[model samples]
Target: MSFSSVPFFITFAENPELAICAEDSIKGARLVLKPFKNNLLALFNVDFVQGLFGLATSGNQLVIGAEDITLGAPLALQLLQPESGKLQRWDIFSAPGNIVSAADSCLAFGYRLRTKPPLQLTELNAPPFPQWIFLPFTTTQRGILESAV
Candidate 1:
């Protein structure tokens, strides 16, 4: 299957030779670890109840964000170690629209209530105890967050 430029597709951090992908459809989502080179040999695939829309690597663990198939249902973030077949899932409490990794942490982000700001960022590295971060948006212009080394 062809890969998209979205978070659903990513390269395995530990081994660049292998590609990490999540295919989402009406039938549900499937997470796969395979080589993107000459041939295709899937290392492992784990199915989810919803569409897996996010993929990231935090430390030695792989983080997957799943879409809420039903309205008002809490979203999920799955932590996986493909080589050992170890996997764990955590709920997001809120409906998250996307996921990304930064500062060595897996972050689930989306808009919350219409009354609140248009963005909500949550850290999932702690698992079960996600720290919520709110960025104050005053104007229509977006603020740029820069990290200085």
Candidate 2:
């Protein structure tokens, strides 16, 4: 991924150390999932999430080798977005199919998740190396997408 494609959770940090480390340590992993529709999962495109990963597995991360995300195991995810200079947190039921288009800026994505923590990023513990499926988004792009919704 390009610098612009990095997620806001990895950027815009008060402590540059964590932000810098996250940026450099940032890795992409793919998910293998089956088709799903309606419900909260429908907001994202599962096929894209799998593609973001390397299409294979390396230690903790699984790379997407195919379009079907249903092939992989279900892992927990904490969705974080930049809000009021802080990251807003949500725990959503996300699978590979839950991921959608990520803008070049990597701040947001097209899919929405059912926040497990009720949209509180500060209250959540974002694991450093938890198995994840990420989608990059830009602030401008998110606005447009949200408007459509």
Q: Which ten residues in a row have the lowest lDDT in candidate 1?
A: 132-141
lDDT of each: 0.31, 0.22
Q: Candidate 2: where are CA atoms >4 Å away?
A: 1-36, 40-83, 89-129, 135-149
**Each model's TM-score, in the order given?**
0.25, 0.16
Prediction-by-prediction clash tally: 0, 20
Across 1-149, the per-residue lDDT of candidate 1 in tens digits comes to: 11122222233434554443333221223444444432212212223322222232222133443333222223233454343122233332333422333221254433333423222334543333323221111211232222223
* Number of the predicted model whose lDDT against the real structure is largest: 1
Give the per-residue Cα lDDT of candidate 2 at 81.
Answer: 16
Candidate 1 CA-lDDT value: 0.31
Q: CA shift at 80, candidate 2, in angstroms?
A: 13
Candidate 2 lands at a TM-score of 0.16
Name every residue pair that clashes in candidate 1.
none
